[model samples]
Target: MSYVSSVFQRIKVRNANEPEFLQAVEEVFKSLEPVLEKHPEYISANILERITEPERQIIFRVSWVDDQGVLQINRGFRIQFNGALGPYKGGLRFHPSVYIGIIKFLGFEQIFKNALTGLPIGSGKGGSDFDPKGKSDGEVMRFCQSFMTELYRHIGPDVDVPAGDIGVGGREIGYLYGQYRRIKGVFENGVLTGKGLSYGGSLVRTQATGYGLIYFVDEMLKHNNKVLQGKTVVISGSGNVAIYACQKATALGAKVIAMSDSNGYIYDENGIDLPLVRQLKEVERKRIRSYLNFHPEAQYIEGCKNIWSIKCDIALPCATQNDISLENAKTLVANGVIAVGEGANMPCTNEAINYFLENKILLAPAKAANAGGVATSALEMSQNSMRYYWTFEEIETKLKNIMVTIHSNAAAASSEYGFGYNLVAGANIAGFKKVADAMMAQGNY
Candidate 1:
């Protein structure tokens, strides 16, 4: 084991509260065990421990008035993990599922994900427990303004930047940015991302995660002597990532037959209707099962995991962590699933990941495969800094190029490290080397 790993094992035993954070860190280190052992300098610099811990964690209370004039309070957090490359960069999630553990896990993953983008952006994550799902527009706005009331004090154009995640979307960003501007009294456009097009949002930011996933999968298919020209695809999650993934995959000539949500999924043999689905999801804010009402040909299943068992040539798990298990991995492989690209953080558990690796299935970890979202966020920051916005074509072209470079770099790192086509190893080693070298150059902080 590497000396840094040895040090981490000791710290992990003493810090039991940070299980999610530790798990995220462990996965990255597991693939880099050999590299760390071969390079003692990284251990001497304690890069492992430093990378595991955040540079700062801000936990505060978000108190706001509801539409009924009642006061509601929730916890908010911003875990600025690392800034070796640039300012802290990541999304701010607003869901009932959010907490310190979830934020820490996401923030830790952001460190390497941002690094993979080859951009000068660092890693950070923040959010609150205020659920916007059932709340009214006025209620949502009040809560977002309160969340930003405290969050704005910590973030700036060149400091920690937050974007949209889960319940935090264009509407939430609008409210948050409004409050930040109201308080700061300046149009700090870059401090928050996923903004409306009228403001500073990039053209393709909404589609980056899904499009990037396909781009990485396209590269993987090329390596396997295949293509997405007419492949059957199954995607999990009906949120921004999964919906856009379906859109991009369909646009690229693939037939996406199935998609899932937190409740269940729908399978359409005639290929999912992207326009209809987007209308239902983005405009209507409805569930996947509701798609059947408009299209009687579609079938809705109650359980979400059933989507994984559906036969497909490509499987993209664009949902939450550990959503894909060992059994699901085996099922996909047995069903001739050639590739699996993660669009979520740690979507596959370690066992599930090892199953894909052992079976020689082409796999792209979330950090590398889904770096497009944050990379585009960094692009938004650039536009904000320069006081100019990029055209739709310009932003999309940049996102595609970044995803392609990330795929190639990860492949090259895997080949150089004797793992050949093992992208997990490649992504970990390549990202680690950049951060590790930076840490080494800066000396112990």
Candidate 2:
């Protein structure tokens, strides 16, 4: 434990201002103590030190013209954290909150998330501090073009592959992929995972994360001698992940009663209308409050956090990081939340996570729980490489198998490490072993 604590102390000193990054390192490092105790070679080889550092970091200026013919500037980053297992693979988030700490934290978490999928992808993440919310189509395209102009040099089909996240969706991916094609002048469809279907995109890529989450939760419930059917669910975030999770949970016989956006949440005692949610958030791009216009019986609250207070059999935090604070954790526990599957990266705070684990609440950590998006992206990469397409049923089957396997591996790891069903440690440890072995076999750089 001294070595782990010492390495973390140095990380704290070196990355003093990078709290997000430090939190990521601390979380994984805590899980690694048992691994280190069992395998002394890992400690002697300084794997912890090297694994924590990114393989490459790129920050560039993105300048584009706005609708008013004004010059806009934004900062972009691509942290190629590691590529030992395979090419660097992760998402590019476009939001005002993106910074080095956020990108690094996400990239570090991506290492384990990708590994837990039992895929060949390494880990990386990219994004810009640009708010693309109100931007016109032309403006968004210009921004994406500008962002890709510099990013293209560092990525390729067998290199770093960036997918969509947060503010970057099909619209953003299409723009980015178009820009990459324009600059490269080649059909490197494998370079990007979230492309349009006509251009080597997978069928279920959009719904993969959300659907995969439910599948993983199903496995977990089955393992625990329970069933997802007849369960009441509450999910935060009305984005792609949340909407799809709600849809999948409903399809699997669970009633998703509440869902939220940043502005507020909607509670429908009779279970949420998934089609209506998709219409409002996806097609119409309206807020969750707009749900009330369609169904007057449903309640709409003003804040996103209060959605956790509603009693539910399960909670899925599909929103942003640290969304479930200690207070929210207490509320969920009090209201009898039996399990929580994180559909977002680091959705729960450390304190909140500790509370859940200590209370013996079934918890699915984000890295393991929300890895479906990237896993399906890797599948898309395989399809692109083979110049073939898979049917929706075929892809869904693959995704289900992968999720079930991930749950099995994580549970086994937790049991082996004396953590029982503590999936947080299990996922981190399982993922770390794969990448650590790869790093060791490849030798130090």
Worst 10 residues of 1 by lDDT: 2-11
Per-candidate TM equals: 0.97, 0.99
lDDT of each: 0.88, 0.93
Total clashes for model 2: 0
Model 1, span 83-115: residue lDDT tens: 898899999988888889889899888888999
For model 2 the TM-score comes to 0.99
- What's the lDDT for candidate 2? 0.93
Task: Report clash pairs, candidate 1.
Answer: none
Error at 62, model 2, angstroms: 0.4
Relative to the unseen true structure, what is the C-alpha lDDT of residue 152 in candidate 1, on a scale of 0 to 100? 86
Candidate 1 residue 140 C-alpha distance from true site, Å? 0.6
Model 2 root mean square deviation, Cα atoms:
0.8
* C-alpha lDDT of residue 84 in model 1: 91
Q: Highest lDDT: which candidate?
A: 2
